[model samples]
Target: MDFFHGQDSLSILEWTLRAAVTFIFVIFTVKIMGQRAISQLRLLDFVIALMLGNIIAHPLSDQRIGLKGSVVATIVIIVLYLIGVFLSLKWPRLRKAINSTPFPLIKEGEILYKGLKRARLSIDDLLAELRKEKIEDVKKVALALWESDGEISFFLDPQFEAITPSFYQLQTEPFDLPQTIIREGRIDLSVLRKIGKEEEWLTHTLRSLHHTEVNNILLATIDSQNNMKVFLYV
Candidate 1:
């Protein structure tokens, strides 16, 4: 209770309690902020993350700083952040201002010097970004843009693009993601039902074809064609 307000002196247990309470409070605050806060650090998200961290961090280190004030400040900051996000969505200009427009770094293998200067990215940095994408030759790039999230997006020229079956006018079968029917020796009944198969059928098939028991299997998946792929535990 003392930790909630300003504390003059504290024991080890009080400090520990403060840490645990602060940790849970921060987690709860972040949960309300949603996945976007952690997954992407756009301008608005960056500001929210920075403020929340600083506000909550002060109370953990200093006994004079109260958890009560920090918690209230965090709530207020999060509400403002959410409001900012909503307003940005409603207004296009605000969105553009918060998350600036992408800068064109390269176009048809030609470097845009003006854009590089505007984005404050050096030639070496651009080269390093290109190298990270496994693009050694700048001439092969059709377009490259500096994204708002400080990441580079590169597109290879049509002629330099990787060959796919479609390029050869070849017909490819439709893709169906394989569903995991069994994992760690446990049958996923929901998946079995989704695939229109019964546990008895899966058991019999494994015994007849793989000569293995369900308990010995570590993982298994079924494709659209009823093709069962099984991997036994090592």
Candidate 2:
């Protein structure tokens, strides 16, 4: 007799139901935990999230680990989490150790090579991020930081004058979206009616931008100046 011979036979229906339940629980739990997703996650936060995922996935995939196992794992994680939270509160040094500090990437218009190396970032990557921030020139950057949460922040040189382009050149300003009036492809129909534009106008505008369907847009906004901005997922 084999120890593995008695493994539970999983049907497609069982798997599907388990997957759905796992997904819903994860989504709901994350919502309750607040919105520190991915790019905004600290190391400890990421680790906790990873453990939660594992806890949620185990009973869903493994027949041996039933709902009881999932509940036990969740309780253990919650207790550990509470302990961590209490410790972080009681000891500031422990909190600091858990949450690493942000590293400075640039200082006084020069790359802090030591910090950059520690951050595993190259000068070219710094330049690319600077350019993404609509800074056409690197000399304008006074300071930059690779934040602990993995977000990049930059400070500009106040004394350094912006480079002046020659006459007759049409310099394009960087694109920025306004405050969201509509979200998740849904028009705030109240605002639309108040602004004297119907759904037809929205459809037309999106069509102009090569978006034929409203579902294609991830976010849509209209500024106080009445300029509309639309964003789509790739």
Which candidate gets the maximum TM-score versus the true structure?
Answer: 1
Model 1 per-residue lDDT tens digits across residues 1-234: 886766665655565556456544654565455323443456666666766788889999998776766666676667667887899899999787667777788999999999887667789988988999999999999999877766778999999999999989999999989999989999999998988888899999999999999899999999999998999999
Positional deviation of residue 19's Cα in model 2 after best superposition, in angstroms: 22
Which predicted model would earn the best lDDT?
1
Q: What's each prediction's clash count?
A: 0, 0
Backbone clash total, candidate 2: 0
| C-alpha TM-score for every candidate | 0.70, 0.54
lDDT per residue as tens, model 2, 1-234:
222234455444444444345444553565444322445876556656777788789778877766754565566556666776789789988776655566777777777889867666677876777878898776678878877666788888976645556344768766655666567777788778667788887788778865557887788888656687777877
Off by over 4 Å in 2: 1-39, 160-234
Q: Model 2 compared with the native: what TM-score?
A: 0.54
